[model samples]
Target: MASSDTKDISYEDLKALLGKSENLFLVDVRSKEEVDKGQIQGSVHIPVDTVEAAFAMAPEQFKAKYGVTKPLLEAPELVFHCQMGKRGAAATTKACELGYVNARNYTGGYKEWSEKGGK
Candidate 1:
């Protein structure tokens, strides 16, 4: 069984963090087609298949490609989400393996965000 110790942030917690943290990076790992329909506002779309490569890029390159500052390895609010949860969790784990020890998964994901009236 997978560890229940994986770091996850809930919708309410994420909302609070969003209001307070200018450093937060909300990364959406869903497909482009799924993302074209709707997404949590302010999320950076980085498809799940490209997550590792994206994370490996230099800071300047990442910013050029994604149009946001590259989050440092220790960034406190580096959060990932998908249409649902699985991909986000996987991305979080991948980030942790890459030294992003503070990485987090928004396990509630975009579905819950939309359902909860997140904009």
Candidate 2:
């Protein structure tokens, strides 16, 4: 996670990265209510409803308030997804602004990902 801009990645690329134990960070930007149905395995939860608030709150405060930890700088890639991909793209942009070099949005998002049965 560096100060490089966030980019969008293809489903194939995401699948390839997920295949390895590489430090790719998958962030699910969907809401908790949304996730109550289902979510991507191994993905971190940071509901879109609280993303801005979580970032605004300092690490300690954020954790105390919402139980979220700060970013792990060692991860070279960060992938964000939402129900339909709009919020995911916006979140990715914000993550890039916050210094995550490899932030990416899965445009196909949860709907498509799930429909593909995890591909």
Candidate 3:
């Protein structure tokens, strides 16, 4: 597990991280309607309301449902984002409480991502 003193990740850091590795796991913790409009490429949708239960599921079940591997507790980059920043921060807290110490909230969220030219 990578140790990060900060719980929040800025858009610049996120963009750089995405550029550097495919190992990063991006979770979109937005509403279904919000997600239907668009989302960060390669991100898996897990609405904020279901974050706790979703993280509690077995890896196989999570993969089956989300069509992506469930992030391991020790993974270096387990990032969450919402339409804005609030829900992502909340979801990051939930993940940390569930033992995902490396979890981080993308503080700028989707709005910033889009405005900043993120794919």
Candidate 4:
């Protein structure tokens, strides 16, 4: 499991990942209704309420449920975000517990991203 203080990824860093990191996994930890409003382009939706199930699913189940390839269990980095930041942080902790070495919460989450002029 992650330490008491979860690791964090900045919005700028997330942008850099989108532009340059092929191994990045961006997760949106928001509800379906909340996601209907807006979300980062290319981010996979995995609501906070069901994140454990999402990650624990079989590869086929993952692909069918999330409409993307199942992210490797040992992925280099798994970035999570929510409307604000807390949920993402909690999810990050969970991801680390699941053995992802670089699970990270995007501290400046959707609200900050939008405020910073991101679509």
Q: Which candidate comes out best when scored by TM-score?
A: 1
lDDT of 2 by residue, 8-103 (tens): 777777777889946777889998888888987877788866666655566788667655466553357778999888999888877766655667
Candidate 2 global TM-score: 0.78
Taking all chains together, the TM-score of candidate 3 against the true structure is: 0.92
Query: Model 3: per-residue lDDT, tens digit, 1-119?
Result: 33434399999899989899777999999999999988898889999999999999999999899988898888899999998899998899889888897899999999999998898
lDDT of 3 at 84: 85
- lDDT (Cα) of model 4: 0.87
Indicate the residue-level lDDT of 96 in model 2.
Answer: 68
Model 2, CA-based lDDT: 0.76
Compared with the true structure, all predictions reach lDDT values of: 0.90, 0.76, 0.90, 0.87
Instruction: Output the TM-score of candidate 1.
Output: 0.94
Candidate 3 Cα deviation (angstroms), residue 16: 0.9
| Residue 111 CA displacement from its true place in model 2, Å | 0.5
> Weakest 10 consecutive residues, lDDT, candidate 3?
1-10
Give the range of the ten consecutive residues with the poorest summed lDDT in model 4: 93-102
Q: lDDT by residue for model 1 over 1-119, one digit each (tens)?
A: 23445699999989998899888899999999999989988899999889999999999999999998999998989999998899999999888878887889999999999898888
Candidate 1: segments with Cα more than 4 A from true spot: 1-5
Work out the TM-score per prediction.
0.94, 0.78, 0.92, 0.92
